[model samples]
Target: MTPPRRFRAGRFLDAAAVHAAADANPRLRRFMRTVAGHGDAGEVRARRLLEHIIRHVIDDVGDLHLGNAVARLERIAVLRERIAGILDHVLEGGTLPEGVRVEALGESFDQLRTEMRELSRPRDGIVGDAPLRLAEDAAAYADSMLREFEAGGGAAGLHSEPAAAVNDAFRAMPADRQAAVRRAAALEPQALWRAVASETEGGKRAAVADLETRLGGRLTPDELSRLRTAVDDLGVARNRGLQVSQARLAEALARIVDPELRAVVAGGDVWLTQQLALHNPEALATLWRRFRDRGGRADDGPGFRAYLRHDMVTYGRGVLGEYTAAFSLSSIELFLKGPDANVKVAGTDLVGIGHDGWVWLVDDKSHRATSVGGVSALTDNLVANLRRDAADFRDAITRLQRDDPGFTPDPRILDAISRMEDAAAEIERINRRGSAATRPARISRALEERRLRLRVTSAAGEVREITQALRDLGLAVEPTGAPVPLPPTGGR
Candidate 1:
């Protein structure tokens, strides 16, 4: 545990805390569960795994301030208790996932851990990380898109820029309507009417009809028709102008060079599937197979990282959520980043080392919770993309089957596909009923978090009862219990 350089109290303590936190890393615990053995072999194997998990976490985080061998060995001793529970479960015939070659598992874990390593190596800054300006513009665009999505537009509308949509629609409006709106606006300005315009194409039309009603007595039927058309055209143009400002925000995200920021900025499932399919193809397939065998399927699909990002975005609206969190903590004397590798490692988002050297580690929820893409776009993206990617996985599997006819999907994966299809359909149903006014259910979270729990209980007498039942049914049932019946000894 290398302490923060300022508090050179001991790096060993920092190492201990890092080890403790790494011990909680899901990959390690999942591995421990996989290699559960009760006796000597189990403990030996468990210690080896503990060693790998701790070393790998520190390595990936690039923090070398770990405590000495004695501290690590002691940490191993503590981890053995977890192994003991795993062994007990295994010894009781707890079904485990099919074992992978340790090398494959290790390689996969290493790659995945790289994805989790905080990308603090700033590409944009002069000294270190250039402080990123809050993406308020992207947030505005997303808000307009969300309003559109709420007003009976499909989830696909999330990508349609309000400015772009209205611009195109206005160009298509009738010429008479075009001229009428120009004259009406020149005389009495529909600034307030335009204010309500960009919600969607449907919303703009509705606003036009309202304006026509307010001026009911003034025009001939043809004149009214032209007036209505002209007013909506101007309204849409106004909305487009506003969204043009908002649309500029999309660039802040697009211009981003960092992969992690881009991924979360890009939305959760989209990033997850792209990374899995592209960067971690080998790791993805391996983890997918491993997770399937262990009973993980569908949205619970192979990506643990995706699940974390979704929760982050769901809670934080994404723009400067951490800055808002940190603003409360900072003073002229406070450190900007976590300077301690052991207690407060590099990835620590907000580190408040008080003037007295009291290191306050604040886990900034906003890191994952908020997004520059706006809340509605981010939320629906997870819902939409999870369904899309699962279908993609199935299509790939089907294509593989075509190449090698004997290839059959793990039953769990098939089940996952079915559930994903059903959930996607359900979300569409919710969208159709116009219940999308409030947040439509997050399909990714539901899909990813849904678990099929199977419980097995061991009884003291079930084995004996089975043996007796077999005997009664006229079958030779051997009773091999303690005081084992000696085989056919002649009178001896």
Candidate 2:
């Protein structure tokens, strides 16, 4: 084995401890039981799948680390993969035969041995035999399997895939030798995998002795089925873990960016981060740079420097809420942008709604609300446009109700719009009252107050009253409040 690097010893030891505990913990035993419930076929398949993942992580990602934590991670990952895969497969409604399981486990053990050897390899110039430690560990595991096997005494009972398969192969050769093969099989496969997974100093030896004493053999169909069920339960555990991982990773990654950007990006203020995550990590990095530049970091001019560095972590959570809202808004955008033939927009009041309500004003391409338009007459026009659009919507709904067999115009929506139109019409009427000779700029405050107190009799009533009050007072109603507030009665 290669001499250990100074940097690797602690982590390696840590990994070893975790792996060992995981291999023998009662939790894993229960986990196996849950997988067994999935059925033997599924458990076996899951084990195989887990083996594949471990190999990939270790060979690919772990190897990249030059036998540091990355390499250990590979082994750890594989072990977890084996455990989780068995659990998931059963839960997902898959199963494998006992023989199939034995072969799969054997392969996993072989790979683990190879990895442990590398892990034990000398980092500096020292030549240490890492495989020796693995072998010693394997022996303990073998003994445990033997004990477990002996307890069963070669009767058709549940054994790990490797143990069962090897026994089956031996039994087929000759009845007398069958018992010997079963005992040896228990020693070889189950114990080996257990040792590979086990990290406790002497746990592997104990496991092996247990196997030897158990005198285990091939599992019956029922045992296999139980194992499969147990494996299936693991899927639920895995999925739950995945959600937590995603949330944490998101939080961690978000920390690397500016606060406002994080807020806008995470709080759902903007679709930018959502878009960025969908692409590559590098793309997200680019957005981070741009966000900083916009905030004045690039030229050291007027950027949001203070916010970028500090406020993000502080305020990121609240912004995440905003981010969720933004996501919904985007969904709405798609409905508006797609198949215009099914929907259409026109007139002034349609444009009058606030930015949130002004669906069309929110840009699909840039993922931004219309920012260029000033917040004055243009806003008024937009509101007016919205009002008009509301009217149009009412008409459209009415038309659909009348023409389409399946159409049913929602009464609540229609009523809401009718109320809005009535308000607008009332404001217009009130404003017109200003033109009358007797009342022109002459209406008393008492009368104006009385008007404000009057019942919101219909949708048009409030707007009319406001318009009339403004014109009579010689004040610009449009520049003032466009939609007058409903009285204490809740409507004008």
The CA lDDT at 372 in model 2 is 23
lDDT of 2 by residue, 157-266 (tens): 21122433333333344443444334444445444345323322255446545544453545444433332332222222232232223465475456555554454444
RMSD of each: 31.5, 28.7
Provide the TM-score for each candidate, comma-separated: 0.21, 0.21
lDDT of 2 at 196: 28
Segments in model 1 whose C-alpha atoms lie over 4 Å from true places? 1-172, 175-210, 217-230, 238-319, 330-347, 355-357, 366-492
Q: Which ten residues in a row have the lowest lDDT in candidate 2?
A: 452-461
Local distance difference test, candidate 1: 0.40
